[model samples]
Target: METTKWLLDPAHSELTFKIKHLMISNVSGAFKNFSAKAETEGMDFSKANINLTAEMNSISTNNEQRDAHLRNSDFFEVEKFPQLKFTSTQIEQTDDESFNLHGNLTMKGITKPVKLTMEFNGIMKDPYGQEKAGFLVSGKINRSDWGINMNVALETGGLMLGEDVRIQCEVQFVRQGINVPVEV
Candidate 1:
C-alpha cells in the first residue's frame, strides 16, 4: 500500500542523550517514555509527520539521587513542567534515505527549533505479515536555550555539566493497522 504510519516501536526504539560531566567522560541517559510517528511509502518522505515527548520525571542516570535532582526545581522542575515535547513542522528530503526534520521543541515551558538528522533504515514484513519501517535519528541541542543549564564550579577546571546535549533515536514503525493515533 501507499499509506502507512511509522509508529514508534518503543520496545526496540530509544531516545538517548549524552552531555559532558565534570570535564571528563560523558554521562548518558535515555528518556524511557517517548514516542514519534511518521508516514512514508516506498520512496518519499514528503508526507512525513512526527512528534516526540519525554516525561521529565522519567529521567534516570541509574543513580537515584541524581535522578531526583534532575526532577527537582533546579533542572526539570518536574512538578511544574512534567513533560518535554517536539512536534515536526517540516520534513525535507536530503537524499534517497536521508531527511532533515525541523521541529519545535518545548521544554521547561520554552520553545525552540531543533533539527534532527534522520535515515530511513528500511522496510520489512514480520512473521505475522505486518509491514514495518525503521529509522535512525540523531541531533545535538544546547541545553541553555531551553533553560536546562545546571552546573557548579570545579576546583580544577570547568563546570559540572556541559551545555551541549547529544541525542540519538532508533525507531521502528508498524503499519497503521496497529491502531496508531495520528496527530492531526
Candidate 2:
C-alpha cells in the first residue's frame, strides 16, 4: 500500500506543453528530452518529492522558422540557460487520487512558484503483472515573467505571441518493484 518511492516509468512518460501565440490562438509544443522523478510510499501521497528537467534546445512547435527563433537570445536563449528545471517545494493530497504539486520552476534565470494541478489517474497492472500509475499535470505560466518576450505587431490589431502560456503533461509511470495493492 506504499505510494511512496515509486519510480517514474520513463518509457511511458511524457513532458509536453503549450503556449499562447498571438491573440488568435495557442501554439502547442513539448520537450523531447525530459524526465520526471517521484518518491511515494503508500496511500499517503503527502510530502513526496518530484523533479522534472527539460533540455532547452529541444523545444518544438512543429514550425521550423518559429522554433529556430525561440532558441535565439530573444526567447529561451538556449546557449545561456540550457535547461528548464522544476523541483518540488511541497506536495499534498487534494483527494484520494489527486494532489497539489507546488514546485519552483526555474527558466532563463527566473525562479517562480508554479502549481501543477495534478490528477492521479489510478494504478493498474499489465499482462506481465507490472503495476502502473498515470497522471495528468497542468499549469499556466506567463512568458514575459521569464523574459521570453519576442513578439510582432499585427496590421489589424494586437501583437503576436501572447503572454500567458498553458502547459499540460500526460504522464504514465510503472512501478519497478513489488505488486502492491493501492488502498485509495
Candidate 3:
C-alpha cells in the first residue's frame, strides 16, 4: 500500500471556538496560527493518523483586552505553554461521510482523551490539478479540565464565562505529490 500524505491548506482551514459569555451570549474566538497534517494508506482516511497544533499566542477574540486576558495566567498562560496539540488515536466510521475521531488533547501541560465528530466532505481536484480533501470537526470540552478555570462571579449569581467550550474547525488538506503552489 502506498502512503499518502496530506498537507494543511492554511488559507482555507480555520480553528475556532465559542463559549457562553456573561451567561447570556456566546463569544467566538479563533487561533490565527494553527496547522494539521494527516497520513493514510492510499487515501484511506478511516485509519489515518492526524495531528494538529495551535499556537497559544495566536488566539483572538476580536477584542484585545479579552484576548490578552485569555493569554495570561488566568487562562491559557501562553508564556508557559506556547501550544496545544491533538493526536488522533483512533477513527471509527459512523457512516460513509461521518466518523468518530478519538484522540488525546494536550493543553497547559495536561493531556486528556477527547472524542470529536468529523464529517468528511469528500475529495476533489483543484484548478491546479491538486487533489484536495475537506473535513468539518466539532466537539466540546470543559475548560477547567485543562486548568483554565478563570471566571468572575456575577451579581446575578452565575459565572462570567461558561465552562464548556464548543470547538469547530473547517479544515482543508492538499494531497502531497503535486508541487502546485496553493493560492489561498
For every candidate structure, what is the RMSD over all alpha carbons to the true structure, in angstroms? 3.9, 4.2, 0.9
Model 1 CA lDDT for position 131: 68
Q: What tens digits encode model 2's per-residue C-alpha lDDT throughout 120-169?
A: 88888866666777889888888888888888898888887788788888
Rank the models by lDDT, top first. 3, 1, 2
Which 10-residue span in candidate 2 carries the lowest summed lDDT?
Answer: 175-184
Residue by residue across 1-184, what tens digits does model 3's lDDT show?
Answer: 9999998999889999999999999999999999999999998999999999999999999999999999999999999999999999999999999999999999999999999999999999988888999999999999999999989999989999999999999999989987887664
Q: TM-score, each model?
A: 0.89, 0.86, 0.98
Where in model 1 is the C-alpha error above 4 Å? 1-3, 40-43, 178-184
The CA root-mean-square deviation of candidate 1, after full C-alpha superposition on the true structure, stands at: 3.9
Name the candidate, 1 or 2, with the larger TM-score value. 1
The CA lDDT of each predicted structure is 0.82, 0.79, 0.95
Q: Candidate 1 lDDT, tens digit per residue, 1-184?
A: 4765566777778888899988788998878888777765643555576787888878878888988988997888999999999888998888888989899999999999989898988878776666677888899999989888778999997799989999888888767665434322
Model 3: residues >4 Å from true position, as ranges? none
For this target, which candidate reaches the highest TM-score against the unseen true structure?
A: 3
